[model samples]
Target: MKPRGTFRNTALALGLAFLYLPILSMMVFSFNNSRLVTVWDGPNSPTLKWYAKLFENSQILDAALLSVKIAAMTATGAVVLGTLAGLVLVRFGPFRGRAMLSAMTTAPLVMPEVITGLSLLLLFVALEQLTGWPEGRGVLTITIAHITFAMAYVTVVVQSRLAGFDDSLEEAALDLGAKPAKVFFAITLPLIAPALVSGWLLAFTLSWDDVVISQFVAGPSATTLPMVVFSKARLGVSPDINALATIMVLVVATGVVLSSVWMRRQERKRRLEEQMARSDAG
Candidate 1:
């Protein structure tokens, strides 16, 4: 038993090390003095020259801005549509073809990204020929494609939240003569706000990190940060790319930590309120 436990602990430590080693290396090399990403300078010889260069690159800056805009729009669109779909799935029962509809809604989540990208490309081409709308491919087209994929993830996250939610509160609201719409806006929406926020963040992160779909859907004028990074990496890794990647890592880590803290506080407050209500009723 002791040997088995030691082996398990060793395996877990090795797994964690393997997972984090690349990220650790990237962070370390972001301050490397060499322009080449692979070559390491002596300890204490680190430099921030690459970071400065990244800031000065206008093309990279523009692509970063474009990525942010697309992520924001995709997150908004995804949350709105996904929330509606989730409500329907949870509230409406025994509808014909409901299973099929649910499967289709989440199919993109498991589908190969290349297949999704190709399918969307074909869709855009057909839409252009039939309706002549969207006239030319650009940010709008990329955003639409991103929203389509992001909504699937958002839907799954929100649907899980809705499934675990109790309907007693809604019934109580209706029994008090509150209209369905009013109750939904005042009660349901507030109750599910955290799930909605989580779904939005998930969608935004998915869109921001996507490269395969974006590569196929984005037009000349809609180049994104990932695209720029990919193009640069083709010529071999540069310290500037490392700096950009490090920045992204820090930003994402910060957001995740803050969100976790906020959610924990909200959960604690809810529990305290519930306890107080029970005490009063007793």
Candidate 2:
């Protein structure tokens, strides 16, 4: 029999392969000389035709651009709103209605997208009937919906980071004559910078990839990239879709790699600074 460690490693490898093999296949077939996304004729048949054609597809270009804009707005909104929510929860102790506020802030994390989408749709209808505002569902409604859901994730990330923080550092800054806002900017915000980055990236990805919620909120002409891809996938995969998917995979992978590298560098620099401070004290 295999050793326990060997068995665990084997299982982990198998799990990774299972998850990534389809993505690998998509990447490979993106270069296929054949029109079918699944068929691979060999290295000799690999061509960049699909990739070249990807730019000429106006629908895809429009959807991708709209998705990027929504993701950027959603990420920024989530960061600002979530940071404030996190600060309130951490710093303002035992306020009235705190429990309710916290619960509502986190409800989106566990709520089904279908329920959220339906509820938002009803809300828009009611608002339009009463005030004649938001004439129709489009980018504005989609952005608001994305912010509501994505903010929950950002709040949780920021809250967890704040929970583990050292409060004495903030207190020391205050005792040394720094203002409350100054202390937060100089010490607290810098300390939680990594969490901020992680949360922003998460919110962006969630908004970008959302289908169920976006589908309900989106106007006929305001379709997102994910919606476009999902609709196309129902008709069976094509070389164009494969090329588009490969491009997405590459972008996501690049972001992940760069963020990981940045985090590691920051961590190493922090440790070195700590060591130097200790040596100076000695």
**Best-matching candidate per TM-score:** 1
Q: Alpha-carbon error at 111 in model 1, in Å?
A: 1.2
Model 2 per-residue lDDT tens digits across residues 145-255: 999999999999999999999999999999999999999999999999989988998999999999999999888869999999999889987788889999999988998
Per-candidate Cα lDDT values, in order, are 0.90, 0.92
Q: Model 2 compared with the native: what TM-score?
A: 0.91
Candidate 2's displacement at residue 268, Å, is: 2.8
Angstrom error of the Cα, residue 219, model 1: value is 0.8
Off by over 4 Å in 2: 1-9
Per-model TM-score, in order, reads 0.92, 0.91
